[model samples]
Target: MIKLRPQPLRGRPTVSVVVPCYNYGRFLPDCVSGVLGQEEVEVDVVIVDDASPDGSSVVARRLAAADQRVRLIAHETNRGHIATYNEGLAVAEGEFVVLLSADDLLSPGSLARSVALLQAHPEVGMVYGFSPTFADRPPTPRTTARSWSIWPGLEWIEQMCRRMSNPVSTPEVVMRGSLMREFVGYDKRLPHAADLLLWLRAATRGPIGRINGADQAFYRKHGANMHVEMFAGVYTDIAERRRTFDILFDEDSACFPDGHQLREVALRSLAREALVTMCQAEKLGQVGDEPHDKLVALAAEMCPPERDPRLWRAYERTQTRSRSGRGPVVPRTVGRAMADLGGRIRWRRWRRTGLMSAVGSL
Candidate 1:
């Protein structure tokens, strides 16, 4: 473990942006420029090069030398991302802190808006805005509002639990530096969902603030992205999610105050995630017997005995769909037409009933 000493601030920056780079030397210029260009907020940038094989250290050193607000932390040995993040956190002295990936870019004026929200609401432990993801090309930037919504922390957690997946992108969210310092840094055990767990922990401390607008940050969805690797089966998504919820339950039991209620919510969330995972695997034609059997066993153990029938039924449906394939074996042209029609129907239903919000309520 690396020991972090607090550094003396020169003029007190309102926000500290930590850009952790690992072999992303090409994107360093854009990432650093984005942080420096934010309007109306005093910001400091710490770029940590985790011993990248690429020339990331060279780029980081250049930025640090050119600007007093920008500092570079170059590790001799390549430490993992979590270690790099903690090192940056230890050095960060701003009231609001963001752990941004070097491959990602913050939208124009995002810092100013997020800072305003946090300044206005002392009850909010974290604030996040809309993060549009792109693959080949970045999206057009939009002007964000100075306005935001404050939702109860528990409410946000419940909504997140119902979704069974992370909605907040990593770069777009900012944490209260004081709250961050109070807790241990991100959980090393949760390699895939550490950010999610951190977000949940922050929510437990205070209400969550959301800046309701587009263009807070640009999440570059390239082949080397961490989530891309996780979904591609580089890590076991099921096991990671289980560990995430376990950590959440253990850490936030005081906030929950009801052990049985927390356990039930965790179980339901796991079961929902398992079903979703099966459906995704079926769509990809990657559902092998061994993994499928393991998923079934995991679901059975997590779910209550009384609720096992419904869970098993859902699991069986996924299995049948995987075996039979999705829809009929029609011609390519007909298949496209059917898919378009189904998408339209789903969209109409979503618009009429607000499917996502309704599900969250449940």
Candidate 2:
């Protein structure tokens, strides 16, 4: 049981969940249900509808009426998701906070597990666990947490810098309310990767925790998903990621002695990603001359020809193959085979641990 802090209205820790809705009225009920159904935690649901044209306000209002724990914030004008998220966060009055999308679902007992970690370890600012994605229906999630992994905040941030990707899928994250309030709101400058930035900022404040061998949330994948609609290509995604790293280091360089080195690490990783994408595009014949040119430009801009001669040479080889109009074929080089194996290993680790394991091992 979560030892209720200070104000224990019902002798339980209250978890305030913020659900942002936009044209997802059809999914609002299921999402709210998952949060309200979490065991052993008192939940307060705040639904912020961003002037969704799909009758989302009506759904939200109905939900609020049906359950006293649910509150509806209907925007008359269409504020973007960032503004909506901030407005909800500002009013959270609970021991813990969660920002869940209207299209996602929280796994059973997830809040309890998260609360337990926060109560036991006052130093852990945030905890997250596996969040599997589904299309039509949510899969049955793991209800029991078999183990926990905790990392020093700085170490986790460095691991994130090396990966150059967002590990936490929004709904799976549970943050201490006091720590979350200190940060205020998500950065408007990073609309595509605000969540990634938020996680990094949280790590700066205290230790990070991860629950293993269990699911924490379910992400719904569909045509209207923001990530799919906004980030249509690998190039845009990589650009935004690089921008995220730049902002992180620019703002908090004082916190890290190796900030410059970590930035370089991130840039090199991004460069390799761009080059790999170029190779994949050449093999599949999916990229046009213009897109291929953009990928090469990104690789050069990130890693430069002089900094990573091997990556540039590989880029040149890929360009030659693209010019020759080759179809998809098996990767023949040992380097390519090793890269594929490493990617698979990382994916499996993420599936089990909700994070990349063995930081600095690569």
Candidate 3:
């Protein structure tokens, strides 16, 4: 399955967007609309409905009715996240495929730009773009990177040994679907984090490319953000993620420092998992206890001198400070209460109206 260049293909390489939907009835339409609104390409949409309790299937079917390119695959019973994506990937016949989560929305021209980037750069195997977040409340802006590049070819098993600069947003990717089939599909072992591991595996095999263009997708940060609802699953995700990397660069491999670095990463992940679990359980005071001390010592033994964590990093929100190092003043009780109520009302209204299509520009 050669990935025919969109530039040289008889027509634009057919780009398929695999939208996996569960109970995201409210955001489904806008998510579908955002992709439908792209420019200059043959777009095929695959809407995989995971037996939504809500009427998400109705919305997806309606879109399929109106557009021939839109196809709906309704499951009889709900399969987990990774399986749903596997189902989508199984049926995809496009040169490039975009994995669009149901709760998210794509920016206009996202697929077009991603396909064009891969098309223009012959050596690039997979190409991705950036995403702006549209959480239920406004999302904080991410620190934009200076550039995006991953050795750009399968020949980078060497470069990946040196730099692991993978900053891909899956929703913003239009990757070579043909090449994607070469590897095992999403590991059911690590459902949600499977994509991140898949990308890492790609890095080990070759190079991934990024289109340094405008924001290409919108990640909705509502109360139902997939990761937010599954905090308990984080450690397991990290473990599986590390195992995936370890398989590629375990000791005895020619990839220098790669095997060593990855093993250290696995140990670090384990320590981080312990710290995070303790933090979530509000057992911060026990950081020097049995499990904690054990993880810390193992981390010291496994990691390079500079990489060891003597004390775990605690995640705590901090107040914004001025140039004088003074934090912003809090309003009086009455004002604070009133502002909270007002915010609740406004967000409820916004949620009711339903943010259709994460708008292209901001």
Most accurate candidate by TM-score: 2
Q: What is the TM-score of each candidate against the true structure?
A: 0.83, 0.88, 0.66
lDDT of 3 by residue, 44-79 (tens): 899999999898999999999998889999998988
Model 2 quality (TM-score): 0.88
- Between candidates 1 and 3, the one scoring higher on lDDT is 1
Ranked by TM-score from best down, the candidates are 2, 1, 3
TM-score of 3: 0.66
Provide the lowest-lDDT 10-residue window in model 3.
353-362
Clashing pairs in 2: none
**Pairs clashing within candidate 1:** none
The alpha-carbon lDDT assigned to residue 16 of candidate 2 equals: 99
* Model 1 residue-pair collision total: 0
Winner on TM-score between 1 and 3 is: 1
Please identify which of the two predictions, 1 or 2, would achieve the higher TM-score against the true structure.
2
Question: Candidate 2: global Cα-lDDT?
Answer: 0.81
- Name the best candidate (by lDDT): 2
Using lDDT as the measure, name the better of candidate 2 and candidate 3.
2
lDDT of 2 by residue, 105-180 (tens): 9998888888887777889899888898899988877777777778889988888877665788888899999987
